[model samples]
Target chain A: MHIAFDPRLRVAGPLQALDARCKVLAFFALVACAASVPAPSWRAPVAFLGAATLLLLVSRIPLGAALRRLLFLVPVVLALAAVVPFAKAAGGEKVALWTGGPMVPRQGLLVLWNVSSKALVGLLCAIILAGTTGVPRLLEAFERLCVPRVLVLTMSFIHRYAITMQEELARMKRARDARGWRGRWIWQAGTLGSMAGTLFLRSYERGERVWQAMLARGYRGKLIGPSSAPLRLLDVMFVVWMLAAGLAIRFLVR
Target chain B: MTAPAIRVSALTFRYPDGTRALDDVSLEVAPGERVALLGANGAGKSTLLLSLNGLCDPGGRVEIGGTPVGSRNLPEIRRRVGLVFQNPDDQLFCPTLFDDVAFGPRNLGLGEEEVQKRVHEALHRVDLATLEEKPSFHLSYGQKKRAALATVLSMQPEVLALDEPTSALHPRARREMIALLRTLSCALVVATHDLEMARELCPRAVVMARGRIVATGETSVVLADTKAMDEAELL
Candidate 1:
């Protein structure tokens, strides 16, 4: 299966000029604030949704594209939400699904709304952050936050070449299809396995040659990139604003 | 006289699966020399190139400027020998062209300012200064190759080894690469099946066949060996 993460979704334009670490930290803080509030507290969800909407407007990302990208998770969210009412605890309060016996509780419906709202808010925040910032900048921020170099490098490589690998697979599939291959499920399964095996072997060999190239250029087990730009005063202000807003919503409102 | 830039004697290598890739290969490259290694497919040209940087340890004699290729000298040897693989994708693994070019210098523990300086100079050398911030995957094949070259050149290697340097370049790109190589002072050893490239870029040529050296001499004379080329099925 092909994994598609659109690089264009990464932050671009003026917002991209803001520090990446600030955006990442702000995202996590907002998610925490959104997730912790009780189901009865509709104010938290409203506040979170407002913030997300503001971010989308300011970041200049099309709302339609953001929703479309997030739509892939809708089925899974709905399925999980479907089960919430049954397992939810309520004091003898029963809710009917279709004019029959109790399939849910009143509290369970509230919990379902709570879960769905929190998930959407969190997902939207992430989508905005990812859509605005470039992958390299994000990695730089991650490294600054002390993420392991190897992990960052691995993720970057996967992001860069995963598309190329997918294209290779598509070409192989086409080649197989062109060779008088019938539409038999069993034969297709065998061909698919062979194609996967071939792709793995090719990737392994490519990794070897890449490593050798690294060695030839005096690599000695350390990954180094350009000197990261210092965190700007405005970036610090952004972080402070996020923290203040979150604390106000959490403590002041409660 | 000074030791040859690269020296290999009776070099033989077999894969872990027992496939013989190089068999008793021997060659010498002098300093400030540009030599082209010519061989058909499966003739062990790539294996020999890898041995030059100790990337393929065949347990045979390999010396760079009289220093043996071993674990103790690997870092030093690597600093002196730059090998550009056949595929630029393999060489340009970093996200940005600047980082890829600066990777070698940074690995050498140079200061940040020094690394930046070297990266700029190397990119300038390859005419890729404007592409520093561009992602490698977005680059054209010619630009990727140039970036790969800059990656190695940032390390200031004394000898450059390239595998099939002109296999997939357009005519203009090929000419640009040849001209760039000619302008550089470092010794170069290129392994390729492109005899026309050999004639244009190298002063010396070595013909390999089935993991053995078939002929070596001045580029024109060795390439003129019609009998040998006919026998090796390369003519």
Candidate 2:
């Protein structure tokens, strides 16, 4: 499978130019508020989505790329919410689609709406955050936000090596294919299993070497982050506006 | 006489599986000198290189610029010896080229200004100044290799220990790497199967076999010794 090592677009824009820490805080607030929106609240979720789309536009991220990333989570969310519309809630109106088909409850549909809409808003906010900020700056933002160093370091390594691991697995698959080993049958999965074992072993060995490399370059126990700049007035204003918007959505617009 | 950039005497290492990686390995490289570590696979060249920076659990004396390679002086020793691993992927672990290059300097507790200065200088040295924001995986293999070198060079190590620096490079990239390595004045001990690179970049050569030093002398003279090369399975 083709995977982008980094999903952040190279383009610079207003949203991309914002301090990562502020962007992170604002996005987090927006997502939290979106998640907390009442099940019956359509206006709040729509507003949250509109704001996310606006941010995406301001970032100058191509709509096609953002939509592609957004679509990746849609299927999973739909699958999860799929069952909700079929379940009849207590004392809720149920409508049958067919002669003997499962009844669709009105409350269940609302529940599905709550789940899918909230999830979409959350995912959109995440996509915007990731698309605008590079991984290094995002990690630095997390560090500045008081995230644990070990956790940040683990994320950094995962971001750096996930693609490498994928490429390694792909190469192993190709090597397997080159040896005239096409396993179309269920029994042929044993070869794939062994390949996975080999990949694990290779990754383990590489981890050791990477550790050695880190140590050889004076890596003490601490992982150092990029230098953080002081938050600008614009960053604070943007954050305040976001927080107010989130709180307003939760309390007002009923 | 100036102190050796690296000094190893009677160094030995054994794996947990009872495999000996290095045995009684004694060698030294003077300041500003370049030496090539040549041997076949499993000949302990990489193990020896790791020992220089106290990365290997070894028995015997290993010194970097008169400082012993021990737990106490590990940070200082590591700063003095920059080891570029055989795989660039193993070395460039940070999120971006800039972060990877800045990692060593940051770890040294240098101020941000100094770290940035070193990172810029290191990237410029590797001709990756424009890609400081690019991720390592996005880079071509050759670029990743140079970024890995920049990761170490940012530390400004007095000695550089590179394992297979030109192993997987295309001919042009290899020549570029050779040209780059020639510009450095620090002591260098490169472990590789690339005899041509050794002939071009190093004035001295050390050959290892079965965890032991099989030969050591002037690069041309030692490389010309057919018996030693044959014995080391490097011929």
Candidate 3:
């Protein structure tokens, strides 16, 4: 159940030293601008992708590790891109060129490039942000940035216990397999359904116990958190530089 | 004489489904005294620990640090009685060991400096100072159990109520825990089935069966009584 893209990097780097709030704000702004790049334009997307790669390097994240993170998102993007080249043909538009035997419409190819490029840029921005920050600090940054408390707490719990829950599911699967249940037929899905029900019950009961434990340790209505230190000069400069770069690409690159 | 660390009289509790988890239970622990609560499963040892800090709805009298256990003084009672759950996973819910250990002290409204001091001291006491930044899931079972104790220790409670602290631990870990517990000055009420641990740590022991106290005496004497041990199913 070990996931490959562990967000918490143990190495020290410039990005790791920056305040988490600054990093969060800068990376998200960049992601938003990358998402809004015009479909027909390649300059903005390429610029953003290069900037993201530079940030990744500055963050001390290995190129191989960063690329491995794309394994989850690249397949879906490629699948859609693969399908887009035929949309114009299905719509009865004229093909300007033929690649080998198949008719490749210019509009379809443009749409394919538009989708793949923007998606890759956005995904790279996210990878840089996550790979540099610890989940606890990230949650604290979200809380300070005025995200809804419910959402922050939900994400915090997921970060803390998701692995444990995954382990529980894995153990249940092993027990099911040990019972000589091959689960080859569709009708055997009844066992899977029951297993899901059992997992839900176990999780619900564990939640109760956690609440009681919280109460035992003097938890009141509010969760008191430590006050974060003020942002440093370096942090401010990093964020301002990211904003400037994003704006320059957004307005000037076109 | 100093007031008892914990006092209970005629305490009764029933689950929502009308199962009587505890019935007419009464006990007391002297200051700085270690007492073992010996019982089989379903004998209400955990229910009694829950009632110590007002975590459950129990009728009758329960007091910690001479304050009555009720909704009005629940915060104070919880700060006075540190209750450790049997499962460390349930207790160590925070993202990192430092966060988990800091949780109780932060909840107690201490300043950031004081909170940090207590967190560091607690982790140091449990020999986990180096792993404070690591996530709880990364810790082994033994480390998680000790981290669970540190979570409560940071609160500086007057009495420590531990549920099965030695259960499922290796011999070396059990020995380490026993040596660690020997260093605590506060009163302790440990609920466990490990009779050898009970003999080594507790001077007095209380045996419970069917939500009732079946036997209470010196640890060695009660454990040696074959008749009482058979009736309580401890043997």
Each model's backbone clash number: 7, 0, 0
* Model 3 chain B weakest 10-residue run by lDDT: B91-100
Candidate 2 vs 3: which has more DockQ: 2
Model 2 C-alpha lDDT versus the unseen true structure: 0.85
DockQ in order: 0.60, 0.71, 0.67
Model 3 complex DockQ against the native: 0.67
Stretches of model 3 off by over 4 angstroms after superposition: A1-8, A62-65, A82-98, A173-194, A220-226, B225-227
lDDT, candidate 3, A1-254, per-residue tens: 21222524546788878888999898888877777787768778778888988888887877777777778777887798678877765554545554556667667877777778778877787777777776667777888899898998887667545655666788799999998999999999999999999988887787778889988998874465676779899998988888888888987897
Docking class of 2: medium
lDDT per residue for candidate 1 within A1-254, as digits (tens), equals: 21124533444565667788888888778788878878766667777778778877888776778878778769967897768876766475776867876567887877777788888888887777777765656776777888898998787667646644654677677998899777587757887788899987777677676777877877775555556678899888877877777767765664
**What is candidate 2's lDDT per residue for A82-199, written digit by digit as tens?**
7777665667788775889877887777777777878888877877787788776787788888999899889877765666577678889889889888898999999989988998
Task: Rank the models by TM-score, top first.
Answer: 2, 3, 1
**Interface Cα RMSD for candidate 3?**
2.3
Of the pair 1 and 2, which is ahead by DockQ? Answer: 2
Instruction: Please give the lDDT score at residue A174 for candidate 3.
Output: 95
Q: How well is candidate 2 docked (DockQ)?
A: 0.71
Q: Pairs clashing in candidate 1? A: A9-A131, A10-A131, A10-A132, A10-A133, A11-A131, A11-A132, A11-A133
**Candidate 1 residue-wise lDDT, B1-235, digit = tens:** 8999999999999988887888898888888899999888888899998888988898579999889999899988988999898888889876578878888888887888999999999999999999787868779999988888899999998899988888899999999998998988888999998898899999999888888888889999998998767655688
